[model samples]
Structures are given as C-alpha cells and as structure tokens.
Target: MRTVEEHQAVVTGLLAPLPVEDVPLAAAAGRVVATDLPALVSLPGFANSAMDGYAARHAEVGTASEAAPVRLPVGADIPAGRTDVPPLLPGTVHRIMTGAPLPEGADVVVPVERTDGATDVVTITGAPDVGTHLRHAGEDIRAGDLALPAGTALGAAQLGLAAAVGYASVPVRRRPRVLVLSTGSELVEPGRPLQPGQIYESNSVLLAAAVADAGGDARTLHFVPDDVDQFLTTVRAELAGADLLVTSGGVSAGAYEVVKDAFRGLGTVEFAKVAMQPGGPQGAGTVDGVPVVTLPGNPVSSFVSFEVFVRPALRRALGHTSPDRLRTTARLTTALRSPAGRRQFLRGRFDGEVVTQVGGPGSHLVAHLARANCLVVVPEDVTELPAGAEVVVVLIEGALQ
Candidate 1:
C-alpha cells in the first residue's frame, strides 16, 4: 500500500505546465498570467480633475471665503473626455467636470459645492491648496511599469487593472483538456426509470464539474460496458485530443474490475491501494501518451480522490501558484475515532473556529458529502480524538471564514 503523499506526488508528476496562449481580456478571468505584463500607458495618462469643480490658480483664490468671495471669469467649460483644453489665464477659472484634463497653468480645483452655481462667472467662496482634487499623471502606475507579474491569477480587479493599463488581450496558460469516463455494467443515466438491478450513474457528472471548478476544460464520455477490450478501445480513441483521462470505477480489487484488469498488464500505468479512507483504490499513468487517473466508483470516494490528487495537478498544469485547497486548523466540536494505520478525511462543516462532522465515515454517503464545506483530516497514528481537539481542515467550498 502507498501513503497519501506518495500517491499525490505520483499523480502530480504526470502533468506538465501547459503552453501559454493569448486570450482576450474578456476571457482572461480566472487564468494565470504567463509572463510579466508592462503598462502601455500611465494611469490617468495626463493631469485630470478628481471632482467636478473649478480649475484655477491657487494664488488667485488662496484667501477666498464665504463672507468675502473672490469672483473670477469662467474662461471655458471642460467636461470629461475633452482632449483639446484651453489654458487658464490669470484671474480666471475653468468649469471642470470629474476626470476632465486640467488645463495648463491651473494648480488647484475648488469643488462646485463651495461656489454658487454660475455659468458666465463663478464665485470661489472656498480656497483649496495647490494640487488638491488633482489626479497627477502616472500616480497610480507609470508607463512601462509592471502591471501584472508572472503567475498572477486574474480576477475582476486584476482584469480591470489590465484593461486600464491598455491591454486588450493577455497571455495565459491554456486550460487543460480533461476527458471523464465512467464504467459499470448495471449503470443507467439519471431521469430514466431504473430497473430492479440498475443504479443511476453519477460519477461522470460529479467528476466533470470538479474538473471545471479546478480550471480544466472537461468533456464526459458515456459509461462503457464492463468489458476490458471495449474499455481500452474507447479510451484510446479519445486520447488524441485529451490532455488527461479521468475515469471513476472498476479499479478496486474485485472480480469485475475492468480498469485494473485492462491496464494491469500494461507497463505504463500502475495501480495501488493508497492508505486513506474513502479513496483507497487509485491508479495513474499514461494511455496512448495521454495521462490517465482512475478513481473509485463510490461518489464520495471519487469526489475526495479528485480533490486530493487530480485537482491540484490540473491547477499546477494551468500555472496556478497555489494549487492546493485552503487549509486551516479548527477545534472539533465532537469526539471521533479513526481507523488505525489509515489516513481519514471526514466530511465536516467548519464555522471559523470549530468543525463538526457532517456524517459517518461512509464512502457511499453522497448526501453528507454535498452538505460538507470542508474535510477534517486525521493522521494515520491518531486512533481517537477527544472533543475540542485541534484538527486540520481543508476548505473545499469557500469556507474561508
């Protein structure tokens, strides 16, 4: 039997970083930048106003107040996006809107609220310091400065910054193409009436969604029969376009284990029993030069196996700096017992400081898995943990708090 870390390392070694491709900024969200991106132009490219006000020389209106106002002639009306701006002459002001470029020789901006509403001439009742309400050129970022560094993940704010820095498209690692397949003789699709001996096939849907959440492009193949030759042929036919082949079923020690029976003789793939609860039977290698990872048929086992092994590998291949799920320590709300010599990942619900077990340690309990936001880890040597014991929890569904 192999340890969990050994299997994780073996699975992670199967994939390499994908090639970088230029994608439009609209489609660059959730992708990692492949190289450092420099700003094409400085932020606020020119001096502009931060508020709708009057742009004037501070020396002219430095002592103006509400009781004794300093009246000045309005030389021009400047709104945002005006490229050709006239200069402010001595003892004059320009009516400026927010984001409008400041005219030459103007050193301050007095907000319109402090002055009476006027068009031909304006009243400057309040005095502002020089450079007040002014957005200086290159204040946020200078031209040719680093806008985004390599390995930075692009989110809403990152994409906005990229667009503001004059990037229409960005270079990012291509999403890995994953092909999901499930196999069983007594499996039937959902929404169809099930016979007495048949059960609904759900591993493909579960695995495919997990792949997409891990930043991989996923495509599912219909369940194959439990025949070895047919499974091998079907898998080979799809390997030409897939970067990784993920299958859930038939890898355990059983008479009808087609995945183990089909690939055991091949020199490329290896099957092993990992010393972990819910996800013991694991296999990984290449099939026709495309990487393949086989998981257990139980829904919880399949989901946990994907979370532990495949998800991180896919993210690493996509150039994510942090490939693993967020992990934190929380005190257990109730006592629990784990099997000796096997690492256990129990479904849990974490509320910042305390973690409560969702259900019993059963791999077939899919409902319990759905309600869980985290996985409470118990090491191989820990047979029993009393209440209030600090346990490591991996946040699987945004349980950051």
Candidate 2:
C-alpha cells in the first residue's frame, strides 16, 4: 500500500486549477485575484485632512500661546467629501472636517477642540507642529504603485483597496463547481427510520460543507444506489460541468463495493490503500475526463480525505497561492494508539498549541468527528502516544479549542 503522501500527490496531479474570470469587487471576496492591480490614482488622491481640525499655516500661528493668542478669521470651511474648495485667506485658518481635502496653502490642521472658537475670531492658543495632521497626497499609496498583487485572496480590506483604485470589478479565478456523491446499500438519508444493519449516509452533507469551506462551490447529488450498473449510470448522467467529483463509500474493501466494482475496468485510476487510519482505502481517477476523488466509506475517513487530499486541489483550482491545509504540532492532552503499519489521524480539539484527542481513532465514529476541530497526526512508525506527548495536527474547522 502507498503512503498518504503518495496518494495525495496522485490526486493533486489529476486535478488542475481552472481559468480566471472578471467579477465585481463585492463578489470577489474569498476568490483569488487573477491580475495585478495598479493604483489608478494616489491613495490620499488629494491633500486631505487626517483629523477634524483647523487648517492653518505654521508661520501664521508661530507664537500663538495662552498669553499671546493669534486670532485669525475662519477663511474657509471644508467638510469631508468636498472635492473643490478655495485656498485659505492670508492670515486666516481653514475650518476643515476630518477626511476633507485640505485647502491650498494650508500646511497643518489644528483640531477644532484644540483652539478657542468664538465667532469668526478664533484664538489659536496652541501652535501645531509643521505639517501636523496633514495627510500628503499619495503618502498612503502613490499613483501607479502596485495596488494589489496577483494571487491575492480578496478580503474586506482588499475589496476596499481595489475599489479605491477605481476598479469596479476585478479579475479573479472562478470558483470551481463540484458534485458530491455518496454510495452504499446500508445507508439511508436523514429523517428516515433506520432498519437493521442500516445507517444514515452523512458524509455527503459533511463533505459538501468541507468543499464549501475549502472555497469550492459544491452540490450534493442523490445517493448512488449500490447496484453497479445503477451507480455507473447515475454517476455518468449527473456528472455535468463539475470541476471535481467527490465520493464517499463504495470504494472500500467490502464485498458489495459498487463504486470500485463499477470503475474497475475503466482506465485512469489509482487505487491505493494508503498508510492512514480512519481513511485508508481510497481511489482517485478521471471519469468522463472530469477529476473524481474517491474517499473511504467512513465519516471520519471522508472528513480526513477532504482535509488531507481534496482541499489542496480545490484551493489550487481557485488560484490560491497556499493550497494546502495548515499543519501544527501540539501536545496531546491524552494518550492514544495507532495501527502498527498505518499512519493514524485522531480526531482532536486544539487549544492554543495543545491538542486533546476528541475521541479514540475509529473511522466510523461520526459524532466524534463532528465535535473535532483538528486531527492529531501519528506517524506510521509509532504505535502509541502517552499523555502530554507532542503530535502534529491539521486544523479543519473553527478556531483552536
């Protein structure tokens, strides 16, 4: 059996990133930028006030103090968003509001509170330093400077910056569309009574959420029946323009593994019982030229498969620079054991740098997987871990516990 790393590479190699397209700034959030952005105009595009104050000349207010106040007429009042305003009159101050463009010939703005305002005759009891509270044009960003770089993951701040640079829309990679499938004869949908030897097929919903979390636009298709011909027909018929296909169950070692049976003769497949517990027997191949990632039948296995393999592929397709999940080494709060030959991924909750096992390592434990925020990683060589032992963990959802 191949190691987890080998199988991961095989899946990633088969799934390539999609092309880029133009999207509005609001819609660009969470999407990767496809083009470099240049500042159409300077950041402070014009000389504006950084604070609500009086714009004045340093020379006029040089000796303004409590004992000898320099009284000047309020020549012009500039409010925020005022683009065109006359320059300040000689020997006078400009009453400027915060974010307002500074009137010409005004070197500094003394906050209104700092001055004694009485009618038009304002006494500047405090002398502001040279250029105090003045925001110079292009100081924050120069015209023609690199505004936003390519491959940037657009967020609220990036969206604001892009709009400030006159880009109503940005070039961003389109989010890949994914179709998720779940297979098995012993599986039933939620809200139904479970018969003997039957359970709800939950990994479809869970994996779909994971795909959405990984930045892919995902949809869960109807469960594929366990019959080989039925499964193949449903897969072929429902596989529209999906950039990727994710399947759970029917790929394991059970006798009636319909997914494996249906795709057995089809070429372009890599079957690997990887060296990882909770998610070991898996497959990755192309069906009808669309990339398909087959995860193990178990719930924890499906979640781990998405984290270890599918997430990177989805991120890459969306043009993200860092396409893999983050790995953190943490101290285990409790002891655990792993299979002698397989690398174990224990469901865990991480607080700060400490990872406490959420439960023991079992592939079919869905409730434990649901409560876990992280996966404690155990190397294939080591079989046991004592309490407080350090282990590497992969964060899948939510903040560290």
Candidate 3:
C-alpha cells in the first residue's frame, strides 16, 4: 500500500496551472491575481482641504488670540468642486469646504470655529502652523507604483485597491473546472424508488461540493452504471472542457468495477491501495489529456479522500498560496483504537480543547459525519490513544475550534 504522502505527491505532480483571464473588478473577488498591477493615477490627485475652514497664510494670524483677534477680508467662497476660483488674496482668507482644492499661496487652514465665519471679513482667534490640514497629491500612493503583486488573493480590501487604482478589470487565474462522476450499479438518486438491495447515490454530490468548497468550479454528471463501455463513453463525452475529473466508486478490486475495468490500460492511470482508514482504494492519472482522480464510493470515504488529495490539487491549480486545510491540536475526550499500520481519520466534534468521536470508524456512517466539525488524525504508529492524548485535528467546517 502507498503511504499518504506518496499518493499526495503523485496527485500534485499530475496537475498544471490553469490559464489566466481578465475579469471585471466586481467578479475579481476570491480570484488570484495573474500579474502585478500598477497604480494608474496618484491618490488625492490634487492638494485639497482636510477640513472645512478658512485657507490663509499662517503668518497672517500669528498673534491672533481670543482676547485680541485679527480680522481679515474674506476673498472668495471656495466650495468643493469649484475649479474656477482665483488664487488666495494676500493677507486675506478663503472660505473653503472639506475636500475643496486649497487656493494658491495658502499655507494653513484655520477652522471656521476659530475664525468668525463672515463673507465680508473674518476674525481669526488662533494661529495654525504652516502645511497643516493639507492632503497633498500622491501622499498616499504615487502614479505608476505597484498597487498589488502577482498571486494576491482578491478579497474585499484587495478588490477595493484594484478599483481605487483605476482597474475596471484585472487579469486573474481562472478557477479549475472539475467534473464529478459516480459509477455503481446498486445506486439510485435520492427521492427515487429504490429496488431491494439498492442504495441512494451520494458520492457524486459529496465530492462535487467538496471540490467547490476548495475553490474549483464543480459539476456532477449522471451516475454511470457498472458497465465498462458506458462509463468510458460518458467520461469521454464530458472531458472536453474539464480541467480535472473525479470519479467515485468502481475502482476497488471487484468483479464489476467499471472504472478500473474501463481505464485499466488507458493513459497513465494507476490504481493503488493507500495506507489510510475509511479511504484506501484510490486512482489518479489522465483520461484524454484531462487529469482524472477516483475515490471510494462511500460518502465519508469520498469526502475524506477529497480533503486529503484532491482539495490541495484544485486549490493549487487556482493559484492559491495555501492549499491545505487548517489544522489544530486538541486533546482527545475519549479513548479510541485505530487499526494497526493504517493512518486513521475519524470524524469528531472539536470544542477548542477536546475532541470527541462522533461515530465508529465506519466509512458508511453519513449521519455521524454530518455532526462532525473536524477529522481526528491518528498516526500509523499509534494503535490506541488515551482520553487526554494530543491529536492533530483538521477543521472541516464551522468555527476553527
């Protein structure tokens, strides 16, 4: 059986970065930048007032005080967006609003509260230092400067930065398109009448949702019956635009294993048993030049396999910097035994400090899996763990506890 690390390495080695495309800024959120973006214009663009005040030379009000005020003529009203106002008159004040362009030769802004707001003449009761309350052009960012570097994951702040720098659209790495398929003869869709000995099909939905949560565009194809020819034909027909293909079921060593029988000698596909609990039988390779990954049919096993191998591959293809699930250390709240020689991933509820198993080590326990927020990882060397033993926990959903 192949070790977990060896199988993960194989899956990573088969993938290549997806192509980049230009998308509007509104759609760039959660996408990775493909190239460095430079600022098109300087921030603030022009010298403006940071407050609503009178613009004047600070020297003119040098000795003005509450007891002895200095009065000067109000030259003009410089409201915001007034582009035709004349320069400041010497020894006079200009009534300026916030964000309005500072009149020429004005070195300071005395707030209206300090000066009597008069149209004919204003009284200044205080002095301000030169260059006060002035927002200079390019003070925040200069023209042609790098706004955002390549490989930046665009979130709210990053998208705002792109738009502030005048980018209507940006070049971003396209999300990987994943096609999920399930192959089994004893399976029927939910809400459909099931025959005796048949079960509801769920692996395709589970794997597709996992793919989407890991930043891939996922779509599930109809379930393929346990026939080699039909399986191959369906996979081939849907291989045209898929960046990656994932199939659940029909890879184990069974007489009617459609996936194994159909792709036995095709492309570079290889099937092997992995040294892990729940999900052991795995397959990875290419079909018609598109990367294909196969997982076990059980819903829990399929989800665990995607979390271990396929999630990282899809995230990497989408240009994400961190592709692995977030892991935390927690103490076990109850004793548990794992199969010797196999690494175990048991579903559990993690409460920040202690992890309690939700169910037994069965791959078909979907209800217990639903109540789990983490996967408690047990190394192959350890067969049994005490209640207080420290275990590595992979946060799958809910809070990071």
| Candidate with best TM-score | 1
Clashing pairs in 1: none
Tens digits of per-residue lDDT for model 2, 20-130: 789887787888887788999888888888888788998998777878888898877788988779988788888888889989888888877768865477888887788
- Give the per-residue Cα lDDT of candidate 2 at 317: 73
The numbered model that scores best in lDDT is 1
Window of ten residues with lowest summed lDDT in model 1? 392-401
Error of 1 at 302 (Å): 0.6
Candidate lDDT (C-alpha), each: 0.93, 0.83, 0.88
* RMSD (CA, angstroms), candidate 2: 1.7
Candidates ranked by lDDT? 1, 3, 2
Q: Per-residue error at 315 for model 3, in Å? A: 1.7
Model 3: per-residue Cα lDDT over 343-393, one tens digit each:
999999988889999989999999889889999999999999999999999
- TM-score for model 1? 0.96
User: Per-prediction TM-score, please?
Assistant: 0.96, 0.95, 0.85
TM-score of 2: 0.95
Across residues 275-334, which tens digit of lDDT does each residue of candidate 1 receive? 999899999998888899999999999999999999999999888889999999999999
User: How far in Å is the alpha carbon of 166 misplaced in model 1?
Assistant: 1.0
